[model samples]
Target: MKANKLTTAIGEITTQGYTVIDDFLQPAQLKSVKALLARINGQFLGRNNFEGGKTERIYSLLAYDKVIQDIVEDARIMAICEAFLEDNFLLTTSQSICIHPGETPQPWHADDVFYSIPRPRPMVGLSTVIAIDDFSAENGGTEIVPGSHLWSDEKIGGDYREGDNERDSAFAERMASQSIALEMPAGACVVFAGNTLHRGGENKSNGPRQALSNQYCQPWARTIENFFLSVPRELVREMSPKLHSLLGYSVLSPFMGQVSGSHPLKTLEPGYLPPVSRLKPPC
Candidate 1:
């Protein structure tokens, strides 16, 4: 991203709460990612209405394939993230979302609601949704309320659950009236503030709609997905040092993410054992 173009993107997120990069992926990159996905047999259905019962999600995608790894470190995305989040930002969630036919609209909510910091604050995180297939208003294109990131808690949804999206019909109707479905081309990416109100639209098309999301948050924040347990250390060792940092192997300061008083990256060493494991049994 050029300096001027990058500024425009940041401006959009600052004011509109989101920005769409029309050509986030190259032709080759798009083809490569989809080819890999085709081999994965995407049949894992969501277990709840929030996760979309008819949708299939492949989580921990960075550990799934190389194409996904590349996508995570894409230069343009890193630029966007670096602008909103602090140094050593971590990947909060990474997965492919495939909304199958008949999937219903997800309740409107903000991605950073779990942080509980308060409303109308600067975004603690950033989110991305890269379309793997062309997204259409009729095919579950992601919908969002423009400029809602700056909305106060009281204005978000008064009749909803205290900290979650409300299932109340009136609440849904109010949000639906202001919702704008994102209809984008495959390979395009929509980047938004974590506090922005959004949700996956109902899939009314004959075929499924596929998109992958890679969300990032401030380094001090607890990641939504615990990558340490999900991705093998062996694989982490093979990844670049930058990825090592993104996966929480790097400390925030003197020792924030330290393992056994040692840098977390040390644990990725071959045959490494915890410092406590070397202690002799008490006599």
Candidate 2:
């Protein structure tokens, strides 16, 4: 992306809570992603309503294909994450979401709801959703509340999750009235502040709507996906240094993410073991 466009997109996010990148993926990349999803996406249904029982998600996608790795490290998306988060921010979640027909609209909430920090503050994270299929009003395009990222905790109220209670009907309607169902071609992407209010829309169309979602958070924050456990060490060694950093191999400074008193990357060395693992049992 051109510097001017990048600046403009960041401005939109600052003012409205989200921005769309109309050409984030090429045709070839789109086809490859669809193929990957076809083989893996529907392997399991969401376990709960919050996960959308009617939907399917293939988490840990980066382990399956290089294309996913490419998407996660895309410079354009990284630039946006850089604009919002601090140095050494880590990838929080990487997965594919497929909303099947009859799936209800998800309860409106912010992705950063996990942090328990007051809103109206700088977003602790950033999110990106790339359309894997054409998003339409009738299908399950995401619906976002413009400028909701800046709403205070008092404004969010008790109706929202983070408490896990059912969303209040009146609050749902109010947000519905404010939301815009995101509609874009398959290759486009939308990047938003983690504090923004949004939800998956109901799928009235005959077919399912699919998308790829990646989220990044401040280095000190806990990630939704534990890449260290989910992705094998061998695979991490195969990935690029940028990915190594994103996967928690890098630290926030002198101490965080250290392994056995050294940088986490040291663990990747062949035959390396944690110092504790090498200790003999008390004899």
Candidate 3:
């Protein structure tokens, strides 16, 4: 799609808290990204369980993967972030999530849980899930509760009971009320606000469902994954200057700098610093 169309799609995501962009990546580019993910998974197997008897296959530190980094930093994707977040933007996390067939459904939740630190200002972050393969209800596509981003913490907690039974009942009721099943085609993406209520569907089909989850937040927000720590300096140096900056490696020590007092440059072998810092010092 043209850049203008991508911008329009992002505008809708900003207004509605979620928007679907069809064919956001070209066929060749999509293939390359998929291959890169497969290679990473082959080299290093990473798995985690998000639901009972169901596991979420994930490959983090994707900023180290040249192909994956390129896709996230692509003009089309960055344009969306620029339109929504404007000046305060930083890549928080990027991962490829796969739900295998027969996995249990994931309960509805927001990504905000990571930001446990109380803040007076509104959340200024967005989550984008790019469908690498066709997402269908049969293959466990994502399900979302629209407009739930406005729910306060107390209100969100009040909707559920204390026990498992009550929780299940509440989820069922919510699903019955305002849930929308996402059936995104390959090369399309779903962008939602950080507080949007969403969950993974059960993958009933025989094949696995895969998608790339990329998050961008205001530079000040605490990130879920420590990007600078997880990614090696060797890889960071090879990355585009913009990607390096997005990974929080451009400046020496700003306010949010020294996440854990450790920098990627300190860990990796000599040769990671970019020729120039793309990001300005934090204000």
Candidate 4:
């Protein structure tokens, strides 16, 4: 990706709250990712709901999977993130969301609802949704409201009607609120800010609508999921240095004489530090 293209993508995301990049992943790479996911599914076959049975779907983290990790760190995608968030950024989460056909639509919400920690900065995080299959209105694609990320929380809540209503009324209201359906072909990726108002669409197709959502945030922001605890240190060591760093490593220290344990590995090599010196405490 050229610098100008990367700048344009970041600008669109910052201004509109969402931007779609067509063919973000190569066809061969997308095929390989699909194959790897199929293998994972096979290993857990017969397990109906993998996402803790929270909803009528299967969701799993593929952070330790090399293929998925590589996709998350793809140069094109990184360039876009770099343009918006600068060079240093941490990947908060990388998980697969599978919406099985006939499932009810997910309620409109933001991904940051689970994080109880307060953020010191605004617009410090964003999420990228990579389409594993052709996303169409009939296949349960995501819907979003343009520039809604800048709207007040109360106004966003007020957009929804109180009582149960027919699909026509609901759709009309959504349209009236400036909502847009995100229907894109496979291999494309939709990147949006954390504050973006969006929801999953109803899956009316016969098969599942699969997508890989990779979220990245500033080093200081608390992650929705504890990736370090879920993924082991050994797995982190096996990953590329860049991927390891992106997965919550190599962060800055807040306090003097204290080292933040953000990175999985402590020392780069043996004899790098004085033997008599004690390890610095985290701030």
Candidate 5:
């Protein structure tokens, strides 16, 4: 990635809370993912109401489909996430989002609202929604409220749950007026701060819309998905060290995320024992 591109991505997330980049994936890359998605389509459909009655979702994608590894761990996107969430951030969730025809819009809500942190802190999460199929307003593209990331908690006026689509009539109308559907070509990516208010758009078209979300969060926060258990340990060991760390193999300083007083990765190595250094307190 060029320095200018990194700067621009970070700047967009900083000022507008989001940025859209086309051609994030090569044609070959997109083709592989599309095929994989097709193979497993509808197996995980209608699991949750927030996912729209007509829509379907597939979780633990990295575990099932290896083709997405490069896209999920792309250095360019990681650069933006690292800057936004600071050092030691971790990939929190990765899933396929398939919105079928007649699915309604999800509620307006921020991803980090569950953290319970006081507002005005530097970013705690970052995300990218990668389009597997071209996103169109008629086909359930994502909807986002520009600049909503900068709004104070008080301005939001109340509590929110997942899939809210702005439950308060007044608030919903006000937010809906400003929301814009994300229309982009397949393989495009929309990077955004988790604080930004957004949702999946309604799908009026006859076909389904496909996309994938790769989410990152502050290291100290609990991940939305339990990657440790979901992704097998044997497979995790085969990933790069950076991925090991991102998957939470590395400890969070003074013993956070430790497995028997050592890095979690050790468990994957047969006959491995906890090193004495890890047993000793930090000096």
Candidate 6:
């Protein structure tokens, strides 16, 4: 993206809490992703209620699919993450979200609740929702309340629920009323601040709505998905240096993400064994 466009998109995220970019992936790229998902169909896990009982979710997608790996490292998305989350952020999670028909709307809430800081603070994380299929109102497009990121914890009110997801019914309804469903063509992406109030819409259409959800967080925070365990060391070594670093390979200064006292990337070296006896301390 050009500097002007990038600046505009960041402005939207700052003011509206989200922004959409169309044609993020070419048709050929989307087709390849479809083929990959089809090939790995059985590995998808089924979840209930909060996640939509009929929905099928697949985690560790980057390891099983190269297309997703590329998407995660897309410059446009990374720009937004770095702008909001600082340069030293972590790739927290990446998953395939398929909302099957008959699925109900997820309760409205903010993604930032997972972090320790209270709301209205500077963005600690960011999320990108990539549409694998046309995101229509009937097929469960994401619904978001514009500018809700500016809302304080007191404004949201009531006690935070389990999963750090559910908001009070009345509060959610008010937020939902102001919300707009992000309907976009298959290949578009909606990038939003972690504090933005949003949810997956109900799927009244006959088919399932598929999407890819990628999240990034401050480097010091624990990632929602444990990529180190999910993507094996051999596969991790195969990823680009940028992606590897996003997976927390580089330390966050003095001691974080160290392996036997050195940076975690050393563990991916061909001859680096795990035994502490052969380890080298940090300089």
Candidate 5: minimum summed lDDT over ten consecutive residues — where?
Answer: 158-167
- Ranked by TM-score, the better of candidates 2 and 3 is 2
Query: What ranges in model 2 sit over 4 Å off?
Result: 162-167
Ranking by lDDT: 2, 1, 6, 5, 3, 4
Model 1 residue runs over 4 Å out of place are: 158-166
The digit string of per-residue lDDT tens for model 1 on 94-155 reads: 99999999998987878888887878799989999999999999999999999999998889
The CA lDDT at 66 in model 4 is 68
Report the poorest 10 consecutive residues by lDDT, candidate 2.
158-167
Give per-model TM-scores: 0.96, 0.97, 0.79, 0.78, 0.92, 0.92
| Inter-residue clash pairs, candidate 3 | none
- Per-residue lDDT of candidate 6, residues 1-283 (tens digit): 8899899999999998899999799798899988887776655445645666777888878888778889999998888777877555898888888888998788676776777687678777899999999999899999998988998888767544353244366766676688999999999999999889888998999988999898899888888899988889889988998899899998787777788777788888888887765668879
Which structure is stronger by TM-score: 2 or 5? 2
lDDT of 2: 0.90
The TM-score obtained by model 4 is: 0.78
Local accuracy by lDDT, each model: 0.88, 0.90, 0.68, 0.66, 0.82, 0.83
* Candidate with best lDDT: 2
The predicted structure with the larger TM-score, 1 or 5, is 1
Best by TM-score: 2
User: How large is the C-alpha RMSD of every model relative to the true structure?
Assistant: 1.6, 1.3, 6.6, 5.9, 4.3, 3.4
Say which prediction, candidate 3 or candidate 6, comes out ahead on lDDT. Answer: 6
Backbone clashes in model 6: 0
Instruction: Tell me the number of clashing residue pairs for each predicted model.
Output: 0, 0, 0, 0, 3, 0
